[model samples]
Target: MQKKSLDAVLERLMTVFAVDSDSELARKLDVNRQTLGSWRSRQSIPYALCVNISEAEGVSLDWLLAGEGEMLRGGSISPTSKPAANPQEDAILALFRSLEETDRREIQSAAEEKKRIRDIEQRLEDLTEALAVARRPA
Candidate 1:
Protein backbone atom coordinates (compact mmCIF):
# COMPACT_ATOMS: atom_id res chain seq x y z
CA MET A 1 0.00 0.00 0.00
CA GLN A 2 1.10 3.56 -0.65
CA LYS A 3 2.02 5.55 2.41
CA LYS A 4 0.08 8.75 3.03
CA SER A 5 1.91 12.08 3.15
CA LEU A 6 2.30 13.29 6.70
CA ASP A 7 2.49 16.94 5.65
CA ALA A 8 -0.96 16.79 4.07
CA VAL A 9 -2.41 14.97 7.05
CA LEU A 10 -0.85 17.50 9.38
CA GLU A 11 -2.25 20.37 7.33
CA ARG A 12 -5.73 18.86 7.55
CA LEU A 13 -5.25 18.32 11.27
CA MET A 14 -4.40 21.99 11.70
CA THR A 15 -7.50 23.02 9.75
CA VAL A 16 -9.78 20.57 11.54
CA PHE A 17 -8.54 21.63 15.00
CA ALA A 18 -8.35 25.34 14.07
CA VAL A 19 -4.70 25.52 15.06
CA ASP A 20 -2.49 28.03 13.26
CA SER A 21 0.91 26.45 13.96
CA ASP A 22 2.62 23.14 14.56
CA SER A 23 3.05 23.92 18.23
CA GLU A 24 -0.66 24.43 18.60
CA LEU A 25 -1.27 21.20 16.72
CA ALA A 26 1.06 19.34 19.07
CA ARG A 27 -0.75 20.78 22.05
CA LYS A 28 -4.07 19.68 20.60
CA LEU A 29 -2.68 16.21 20.00
CA ASP A 30 -1.39 16.18 23.59
CA VAL A 31 2.19 15.58 22.52
CA ASN A 32 5.35 17.61 22.92
CA ARG A 33 6.35 19.93 20.10
CA GLN A 34 9.54 17.99 19.45
CA THR A 35 7.65 14.73 19.07
CA LEU A 36 5.30 16.34 16.58
CA GLY A 37 8.32 17.60 14.65
CA SER A 38 9.79 14.11 14.61
CA TRP A 39 6.63 12.66 13.15
CA ARG A 40 6.67 15.31 10.45
CA SER A 41 10.28 14.55 9.66
CA ARG A 42 9.70 10.80 9.60
CA GLN A 43 6.58 11.17 7.44
CA SER A 44 4.60 8.84 9.67
CA ILE A 45 2.12 9.28 12.47
CA PRO A 46 1.07 6.80 15.10
CA TYR A 47 -2.26 5.06 14.66
CA ALA A 48 -3.09 5.58 18.36
CA LEU A 49 -2.60 9.33 17.93
CA CYS A 50 -4.88 9.27 14.92
CA VAL A 51 -7.53 7.40 16.88
CA ASN A 52 -7.19 9.86 19.76
CA ILE A 53 -7.61 12.81 17.46
CA SER A 54 -10.57 11.19 15.71
CA GLU A 55 -12.38 10.49 19.00
CA ALA A 56 -11.51 13.79 20.65
CA GLU A 57 -12.15 16.10 17.70
CA GLY A 58 -15.00 14.19 16.07
CA VAL A 59 -13.10 13.92 12.79
CA SER A 60 -13.36 11.13 10.23
CA LEU A 61 -10.18 9.04 10.10
CA ASP A 62 -10.71 8.44 6.39
CA TRP A 63 -10.78 12.16 5.61
CA LEU A 64 -7.87 12.94 7.86
CA LEU A 65 -5.73 10.09 6.59
CA ALA A 66 -6.73 9.93 2.91
CA GLY A 67 -8.78 13.09 2.17
CA GLU A 68 -11.76 10.99 1.17
CA GLY A 69 -15.42 11.52 2.05
CA GLU A 70 -16.55 14.05 4.71
CA MET A 71 -14.23 15.30 7.41
CA LEU A 72 -16.45 14.46 10.32
CA ARG A 73 -17.93 11.03 11.04
CA GLY A 74 -21.43 12.53 11.20
CA GLY A 75 -20.60 14.68 8.13
CA SER A 76 -20.74 17.88 10.20
CA ILE A 77 -17.89 20.30 9.80
CA SER A 78 -15.91 21.31 12.83
CA PRO A 79 -17.14 24.57 14.37
CA THR A 80 -13.94 26.45 13.63
CA SER A 81 -13.47 30.20 13.46
CA LYS A 82 -11.36 29.82 10.33
CA PRO A 83 -13.01 28.78 7.08
CA ALA A 84 -11.78 25.64 5.33
CA ALA A 85 -9.45 26.22 2.39
CA ASN A 86 -11.48 24.12 -0.07
CA PRO A 87 -14.58 25.88 -1.36
CA GLN A 88 -15.68 22.76 -3.27
CA GLU A 89 -15.77 20.83 -0.03
CA ASP A 90 -17.80 23.63 1.47
CA ALA A 91 -20.22 23.60 -1.46
CA ILE A 92 -20.65 19.85 -1.23
CA LEU A 93 -21.33 20.22 2.49
CA ALA A 94 -23.96 22.86 1.75
CA LEU A 95 -25.68 20.60 -0.78
CA PHE A 96 -25.69 17.70 1.66
CA ARG A 97 -27.16 19.87 4.36
CA SER A 98 -29.87 21.16 2.02
CA LEU A 99 -31.10 17.63 1.36
CA GLU A 100 -34.56 16.75 2.73
CA GLU A 101 -34.99 14.81 5.97
CA THR A 102 -36.03 11.62 4.21
CA ASP A 103 -33.13 11.93 1.80
CA ARG A 104 -30.69 12.28 4.66
CA ARG A 105 -32.24 9.26 6.37
CA GLU A 106 -31.87 7.23 3.22
CA ILE A 107 -28.23 8.22 2.91
CA GLN A 108 -27.52 7.30 6.49
CA SER A 109 -29.36 4.01 6.14
CA ALA A 110 -27.37 3.08 3.06
CA ALA A 111 -24.13 4.01 4.76
CA GLU A 112 -24.97 1.92 7.83
CA GLU A 113 -26.82 -0.98 6.20
CA LYS A 114 -24.66 -3.67 7.83
CA LYS A 115 -25.15 -2.19 11.28
CA ARG A 116 -28.91 -1.92 10.63
CA ILE A 117 -29.11 -5.57 9.62
CA ARG A 118 -27.28 -6.63 12.79
CA ASP A 119 -29.69 -4.54 14.87
CA ILE A 120 -32.67 -6.15 13.13
CA GLU A 121 -31.26 -9.61 13.79
CA GLN A 122 -30.81 -8.80 17.47
CA ARG A 123 -34.41 -7.59 17.66
CA LEU A 124 -35.60 -10.79 16.02
CA GLU A 125 -33.69 -12.89 18.56
CA ASP A 126 -35.17 -10.92 21.47
CA LEU A 127 -38.70 -11.29 20.08
CA THR A 128 -38.18 -15.02 19.58
CA GLU A 129 -37.14 -15.38 23.20
CA ALA A 130 -40.17 -13.40 24.31
CA LEU A 131 -42.48 -15.59 22.23
CA ALA A 132 -40.95 -18.72 23.72
CA VAL A 133 -41.57 -17.38 27.24
CA ALA A 134 -45.17 -16.53 26.34
CA ARG A 135 -45.79 -20.06 25.11
CA ARG A 136 -44.57 -21.65 28.36
CA PRO A 137 -47.06 -22.34 31.21
CA ALA A 138 -46.37 -20.67 34.55
Candidate 2:
Protein backbone atom coordinates (compact mmCIF):
# COMPACT_ATOMS: atom_id res chain seq x y z
CA MET A 1 0.00 0.00 0.00
CA GLN A 2 1.15 3.53 -0.70
CA LYS A 3 0.90 6.62 1.44
CA LYS A 4 -2.67 7.85 1.98
CA SER A 5 -2.56 11.60 1.84
CA LEU A 6 -5.43 14.02 2.34
CA ASP A 7 -5.78 14.14 -1.41
CA ALA A 8 -6.30 10.39 -1.51
CA VAL A 9 -8.79 10.57 1.31
CA LEU A 10 -10.73 13.29 -0.45
CA GLU A 11 -10.56 11.39 -3.68
CA ARG A 12 -11.85 8.24 -2.05
CA LEU A 13 -14.63 10.24 -0.51
CA MET A 14 -15.51 11.61 -3.90
CA THR A 15 -15.68 8.08 -5.20
CA VAL A 16 -17.87 7.02 -2.33
CA PHE A 17 -20.14 10.03 -2.72
CA ALA A 18 -20.17 9.62 -6.50
CA VAL A 19 -19.15 13.19 -7.16
CA ASP A 20 -17.24 14.06 -10.28
CA SER A 21 -15.53 17.17 -8.95
CA ASP A 22 -14.53 18.93 -5.75
CA SER A 23 -17.20 21.54 -6.32
CA GLU A 24 -19.86 18.82 -6.44
CA LEU A 25 -18.41 17.18 -3.38
CA ALA A 26 -18.52 20.47 -1.52
CA ARG A 27 -22.13 20.93 -2.51
CA LYS A 28 -23.01 17.45 -1.26
CA LEU A 29 -21.09 17.99 1.97
CA ASP A 30 -22.86 21.35 2.38
CA VAL A 31 -19.57 23.25 2.51
CA ASN A 32 -18.39 26.01 0.25
CA ARG A 33 -16.04 25.20 -2.63
CA GLN A 34 -13.40 27.50 -1.14
CA THR A 35 -13.73 25.68 2.16
CA LEU A 36 -13.04 22.41 0.33
CA GLY A 37 -10.03 24.05 -1.31
CA SER A 38 -8.84 25.21 2.09
CA TRP A 39 -9.10 21.67 3.39
CA ARG A 40 -6.99 20.50 0.51
CA SER A 41 -4.48 23.24 1.23
CA ARG A 42 -4.31 22.33 4.93
CA GLN A 43 -4.48 18.54 4.45
CA SER A 44 -7.04 18.19 7.21
CA ILE A 45 -10.70 17.46 7.53
CA PRO A 46 -12.90 18.03 10.54
CA TYR A 47 -13.30 14.90 12.65
CA ALA A 48 -16.95 15.50 13.37
CA LEU A 49 -17.89 15.78 9.73
CA CYS A 50 -16.00 12.62 8.89
CA VAL A 51 -17.77 10.78 11.67
CA ASN A 52 -21.09 12.12 10.46
CA ILE A 53 -20.49 10.80 6.96
CA SER A 54 -19.26 7.43 8.16
CA GLU A 55 -22.30 6.80 10.31
CA ALA A 56 -24.91 8.41 8.12
CA GLU A 57 -23.79 6.82 4.88
CA GLY A 58 -22.98 3.40 6.31
CA VAL A 59 -19.32 3.65 5.40
CA SER A 60 -16.31 2.37 7.27
CA LEU A 61 -14.54 4.87 9.52
CA ASP A 62 -11.30 2.97 9.03
CA TRP A 63 -11.53 3.52 5.31
CA LEU A 64 -12.56 7.13 5.71
CA LEU A 65 -9.76 7.99 8.12
CA ALA A 66 -6.79 5.81 7.26
CA GLY A 67 -7.69 4.07 4.03
CA GLU A 68 -7.18 0.79 5.86
CA GLY A 69 -10.35 -0.96 4.82
CA GLU A 70 -13.15 -1.26 2.31
CA MET A 71 -15.35 1.77 1.89
CA LEU A 72 -18.35 -0.08 3.30
CA ARG A 73 -18.83 -1.03 6.92
CA GLY A 74 -17.76 -4.45 8.27
CA GLY A 75 -15.08 -4.90 5.64
CA SER A 76 -11.36 -4.33 5.91
CA ILE A 77 -8.32 -4.72 3.69
CA SER A 78 -8.48 -8.48 3.81
CA PRO A 79 -11.00 -10.08 1.56
CA THR A 80 -11.95 -12.72 4.10
CA SER A 81 -11.98 -10.46 7.12
CA LYS A 82 -15.04 -9.82 9.23
CA PRO A 83 -15.43 -6.73 11.35
CA ALA A 84 -16.59 -8.54 14.46
CA ALA A 85 -16.59 -12.26 15.08
CA ASN A 86 -17.45 -12.27 18.74
CA PRO A 87 -21.11 -12.14 19.58
CA GLN A 88 -20.59 -9.87 22.57
CA GLU A 89 -18.55 -7.52 20.42
CA ASP A 90 -21.25 -7.51 17.78
CA ALA A 91 -23.82 -6.60 20.40
CA ILE A 92 -21.67 -3.82 21.76
CA LEU A 93 -21.05 -2.51 18.27
CA ALA A 94 -24.75 -2.54 17.58
CA LEU A 95 -25.35 -0.48 20.70
CA PHE A 96 -22.60 1.92 19.80
CA ARG A 97 -24.01 2.41 16.35
CA SER A 98 -27.40 3.22 17.80
CA LEU A 99 -26.11 6.25 19.68
CA GLU A 100 -26.26 9.80 18.40
CA GLU A 101 -23.29 11.18 16.50
CA THR A 102 -22.22 13.43 19.36
CA ASP A 103 -22.43 10.61 21.84
CA ARG A 104 -20.58 8.27 19.56
CA ARG A 105 -17.84 10.85 19.13
CA GLU A 106 -17.59 11.35 22.89
CA ILE A 107 -17.22 7.62 23.32
CA GLN A 108 -14.60 7.40 20.59
CA SER A 109 -12.62 10.29 22.06
CA ALA A 110 -12.73 8.80 25.52
CA ALA A 111 -11.66 5.41 24.19
CA GLU A 112 -8.76 6.96 22.31
CA GLU A 113 -7.71 8.88 25.39
CA LYS A 114 -7.84 5.74 27.46
CA LYS A 115 -5.73 3.94 24.92
CA ARG A 116 -3.22 6.81 24.97
CA ILE A 117 -2.94 6.62 28.73
CA ARG A 118 -2.50 2.87 28.60
CA ASP A 119 0.14 3.18 25.95
CA ILE A 120 2.12 5.62 28.11
CA GLU A 121 1.74 3.52 31.23
CA GLN A 122 2.74 0.32 29.49
CA ARG A 123 5.57 1.92 27.50
CA LEU A 124 3.98 0.48 24.40
CA GLU A 125 3.36 2.40 21.18
CA ASP A 126 3.42 6.19 20.93
CA LEU A 127 0.62 8.39 22.24
CA THR A 128 -1.03 8.47 18.83
CA GLU A 129 -0.83 4.67 18.71
CA ALA A 130 -0.41 4.91 14.99
CA LEU A 131 2.26 2.25 15.20
CA ALA A 132 0.09 -0.09 17.18
CA VAL A 133 -0.82 -3.24 15.27
CA ALA A 134 -4.12 -4.95 16.02
CA ARG A 135 -3.45 -7.93 13.82
CA ARG A 136 -3.88 -11.46 15.10
CA PRO A 137 -0.73 -13.53 14.93
CA ALA A 138 -0.76 -16.22 12.32
What is the Å distance of residue 83 in model 1 from its true position?
A: 21
- Tens digits of per-residue lDDT for model 1 on 1-138? 133567778877876765667898899878899998888677788978788888888889998888688868887546785575798978876887788534554555465777879999999999999999999999
The prediction achieving the highest TM-score against the true structure is 1
lDDT agreement with native, every candidate: 0.77, 0.74
RMSD of model 2 against the true structure = 14.5
Candidate 2's TM-score: 0.51
Estimate the TM-score for candidate 1: 0.52
How close to the true structure is residue 100 of candidate 2, measured as C-alpha lDDT?
55
What clash count does candidate 2 reach? 0
- By summed lDDT, the worst window of 10 consecutive residues in model 2 runs over 127-136
